[model samples]
Target: MQTNNSVLVTQQIKTWLEQVVIGLNLCPFAKRPYKQKQVKIAISTASDDDTLLQDLLQQFKLLENTPIETTETSVLVVTNHLQDFFDYNDFLNLADALIEQYNWQGVFQIASFHPHYQFAGTTEQDPENLTNKAPYPILHILRESSLDKAVESHPDVDGIPEQNIAKMNQLTKEQITELFGYLKD
Candidate 1:
């Protein structure tokens, strides 16, 4: 049962991934899986932590049951909860604990993205923080094996963050507004 708002939210995320994440080459590994339609964008309408945790577990189970070729990764879009960056950041600890509790630590990993993502030592308006910002709070579930393969094949895996930050720094004010217009709302 998906609502129009859910559909719109999913589309907004897809656009962000395509135009910003992959188009700008922020993630070298993303283009392949995305183009192959192996990326799953799941929208969670949960407004509470408990329900959100359940949704996250379902995503973990889905990835565990599905093959790599069929579904390489999943981005769980949290629509109603964790809008506050601090709360979202705090919830990541519980997300990790859940992985450990389920013994999925080695099998899966979670990457976070949020509308107001801010890295440590960076101000809220810092351009570098824009690197992780998305239309809504997102829990990007990734397969450890696939990530290992990608890292093994890539030449400079450790440089990706620095490179992304540099790219974000290079963007003009107008360019930032153009790319992240949804943030204005």
Candidate 2:
């Protein structure tokens, strides 16, 4: 039932999750859900903003209606389009609007990832951007209740970003390229 491209993308995402994310301890919270098979990766074929928004809403609804134990979160991988970081960033507003419209604001939150995820005001080459950068554009949808629980249980939740940035900064460009070779053009 799966296309070749779909299978490949899913496997690539799994590799990134296991190797880059968990291997480097970039996201301490990711390993558990991934290991438990609760993280769903949905590939979207929408080639433009209009269609992508529809695809986003559908994923949002799927996560909302599904049982939490079976599905904790979803990553909407926009492989057909939104390769441009700014375009991907701008589309998030529409995603939030849809969430608000469906009254799912508190139920879910969106985190962004892309190949070139530069935070505002930061230089493009800043290693800190690696925190959010992925092999493709991804909108990570998470349940707020679970997130809140995780945050409440953590001793130093506030230090996570600083720690991630510091960790990423230690890697030189060659190291990053070697680790994330698939992302290169």
Index of the highest-TM-score prediction? 1
TM-score of 2: 0.95
lDDT of 2 at 167: 85
Which candidate tops lDDT?
Answer: 1
lDDT of 2 at 183: 59
User: Could you tell me how far off, in angstroms, the CA of residue 107 lies in candidate 2 after the best superposition?
Assistant: 0.6
lDDT (0 to 1) per candidate: 0.94, 0.87
Clashing pairs in 2: none
Model 1 Cα lDDT, one tens digit per residue, 159-178: 99999999999999999998
TM-score of each predicted structure versus truth: 0.98, 0.95
Ten residues in a row with the worst lDDT in model 1?
176-185
Error of 2 at 173 (Å): 3.7
